[model samples]
Target: MDEVLADPIDKFISLYQRDHGFNYTLEQMHGKEFGELLPEELLPSLRVYLNQKGFFRDLKVIPGAIETVEKLCEKYEVFIVSAATEFPLSLEDKQAWLADHFPFISWTNIIFCGYKIVDVDIMIDDRARNFNPKIGRHLLFTSPHNVGLTEYERVNNWAEVAEKLL
Candidate 1:
């Protein structure tokens, strides 16, 4: 759920700009895979960087994420769930990242697994397929790449999410 609360693409752009001079703005990256948007030669290495050390640690918090999550936590049993099996290398890094950025969240509240199989009243995620409608209502966290996915309820930013649920 880092993508729901962290701006990884912006962090990648900064790193990519420093190493390869790929001066892309976030708006232009909307609706496209960040790696595919890069020059072909850089794609492989950049994708490798995704799970590398220090990558998740430096990601900036998505605008309004901290405040919104704090508000939600006050009113609900907030769980910071993430699909972690795909990036085995990132499990610890992601946990460290959460502790570093979200000190208010307890270790017991974090759930890491392959599929998001938890049963809950609602789930907010950037990826559309992570939640099943029969199990819970899905609130799509609008990210650049997921902006065009319109099948579910979409919240453009945390403010909208707060408006809907809080």
Candidate 2:
């Protein structure tokens, strides 16, 4: 089950940087004080533009996401836990976007709440800080934007992540 993760966003960033020669981080793209290149209202539109412009066309799923989730689903009840900004997106639009991008995922199992904590055995996310405190194991997906996070079980790719989970 895929989530509304920054992988698509990350792909956009890299493509934007490589093709347009704009070097910017996600924080800078969304930061309150420093996020001036794009207006707040345009952020979501920009993301959509990026998505449409082949930003996620050939994105490599985290190395181990498929295998790990496939394996874990056999033991624990695995589900997607995501937090999307309630900005210009109405709840419906956000849900629609998630649904369109991840048609293979089960919307019933998705939790679109602000906080990431849920009664679960394990959780994997790009943001380690948002992990559920009640979770026993925290698998951190390494993101180019999340380089400052170094305390968790950081895996550079999904394949590495699958190795750790298995």
Candidate 3:
């Protein structure tokens, strides 16, 4: 759900800037996780922000995501799989966010768990580690942390996703 359909980094940036007065551009985050850009002492606080209630509720939807995914649904069984166990507090907010933004998707199609072990013919995610090359065609959704990665096919935006999948 994160970087793929929703802009969680925006949430992180908003809270980080409001609290620390340091604004970060996406370019500054290229090829690195958001925490890696912060001072070591501030790492714990970053985790705190992620754990706070409503942190995942209002993330901006990625451009073209809703329209593209809705189009894809016409041809495929769509799912909103999220790795939510890591931040227990975000489970509810993520669900609510999805409901508000992607109401066409059914609740039964959403999966919130620690491990993404679902068997699918194609998987789109920002994290390269989550891909099992032998299992399916994995499309790497471009995100700051995965910018340097080149092992898989990459889609930089939802429009690209529509062109490729729809």
- TM-score-based ranking: 3, 1, 2
The number of the candidate with the highest TM-score is 3
Report the Cα lDDT for candidate 3.
0.91
Clashes within 3 Å, all models in order: 0, 6, 0
Model 1 Cα lDDT, one tens digit per residue, 14-102: 88889888799988878977876887877788758876867776688888888999889999999988887677787887889888888
Q: Which candidate tops lDDT? A: 3
Model 3 TM-score (2 dp): 0.97
Screening candidate 2 with a backbone cut-off below 3 angstroms (N, C-alpha, C), the clashing residue pairs are 62-158, 63-157, 63-158, 63-159, 64-158, 64-159
How does candidate 2 score on lDDT? Answer: 0.56
Ranked by lDDT, the better of candidates 1 and 3 is 3
Report, for every candidate in turn, its global Cα lDDT versus the true structure.
Answer: 0.84, 0.56, 0.91
Residue-by-residue lDDT tens digits, candidate 3, 37-91: 8989999998798899999999999999999999999999988889999999999
Model 2: per-residue Cα lDDT over 47-152, one tens digit each: 5553353333444454445555566566666676656433334334445544565544567766766766588777777676677667888877655446666678
TM-score of 1: 0.93
